[model samples]
Target: MVPDPDLQLQMVIKALSETVSTAVDPGNKVAQEQLHLSIATLGMMRSRLPMTRRFYRALAQDALTLAKDLEEKTGQSGALTQAMNDVGQALTDPGIENEAIEQSRARLHEAITDHLAQIDKSLGTVARDIVMQGSLGSIERQRAWFVESGFEPNADRIPAISELIQTPDHP
Candidate 1:
């Protein structure tokens, strides 16, 4: 059940775009919260999915650019600026092993779990299942890409990523 890499990439791009759009109104509390959660999830995906890294990076860059524009227009740093900075910092140096890397992985796992909970709550069980299946497929493809490219998978993160893939009923 491997999802198409291109499709998965497109989905991520869409998600990022939506996140930016939702964050456009600085006064919107719900949108701000969504932006925060979405960026964290995007960062997690960027770290875990090698094939989608470029797209994720592009999204992060776009958010940063948008933040800069908004700040210049408004003459003050806003939530968007802070959110973009957080996401950019997350994607900037995803090293294989380091205290920072470990912290990033932990944040990613927490974000993923929160996202799955939201999906299950808002979209119903069927949609949640579809998303989970797609995510697992995407992760498998990422692992395969790392192997094919002669890079060892990050040993510390692999088990955490695998844990996200496992169904509660199965293990």
Candidate 2:
């Protein structure tokens, strides 16, 4: 999307490195620094995302609560657009070699996804938990849906959660 904001990503990593992971890993400290910076930059940009009142209700809650509270703010589009500019610039940070950062990012995602695939913990979708919990109260709705089809609302929840965990987060 948006022609791969390479520099912006680097900037964002440079921004976030300070907060996400700052350990002295054996693998490329320079890369780590750049990544952290980039993430921090993006986090800062994300702060301007309007933070709608709907979301405010769940501001102190966990991810699931937050997502469920999304009534969609009215004036966030401008903020998101500005954030894109910040992301673009961050992706193109010159402090860290852009080409090397790209390569490392690719490898990193591959490794992370590989690890996620092997994880078998039964934790259903984090952001969807509120919706699922809401459904739990509707036993009649569950039964009716079950009767109409060969699906059960109580089925396959853990697997769903595990997959949700696989979704990447900068933090």
Candidate 3:
């Protein structure tokens, strides 16, 4: 059965609230777990949403706030920091580059590249082949798969990536 998107969004907000309330101790295992889980949940929600600029902005704002809170409490750089950076990079407007945003993106990109390399090493050839094969299909085919997998067909708006991913060659 399909899940209610509104309900899922509420759950994500509730999880974020709970994480904020219990996140006093940066080293606390429970708090760390909650924070990570909340982040993952938010990412999933963002992926499922119709990709309007407003939606992206809202998600970025929430993630930025959460990342700031985590940084303040932990006094260290980690996944939250990287997530914040990625959102910032992904949301940046063209021809209006900011130094801080650029720096954050660079750091996050480097970290993710390292992580992906580690995964590639660990998962070996079979996983790599599987991932490559999966990614080789057209976006329309992927959309069909999403529909088959029970995603709502009538997304409120076209995903922002549809516009952003287009290049002169493709267009």
- Each candidate: how many clashes? 0, 35, 0
Worst 10 residues of 1 by lDDT: 162-171
lDDT of 2 by residue, 1-171 (tens): 653555565555654565446554649878776765556556544442332221211211222222222212111233333333333333345464444444443343343234334433442243234335533423332243233232556553323222222223211
Candidate 3 lDDT (Cα, whole model)?
Answer: 0.48
TM-scores for the candidates:
0.27, 0.20, 0.25
Best by lDDT: 3
In the range 48-151, model 1's lDDT, one tens digit per residue, is 56434443343334334433443343334343444545655765665533444335434443443444444324445544454454355445435543432325
Give the poorly placed runs of model 3, Cα more than 4 Å off. 1-51, 94-171
RMSD of each: 23.8, 21.1, 21.0
In model 1, state the lDDT of residue 85. 51
Model 3 C-alpha lDDT per residue in residues 105-132, reported as the tens digit of each score: 4455454334345443544554345434
Alpha-carbon runs more than 4 Å astray in model 1:
1-50, 96-171
Best by TM-score: 1
Which scores better on TM-score, 1 or 3? 1
Q: Residue 94: error of model 2 in Å?
A: 6.8
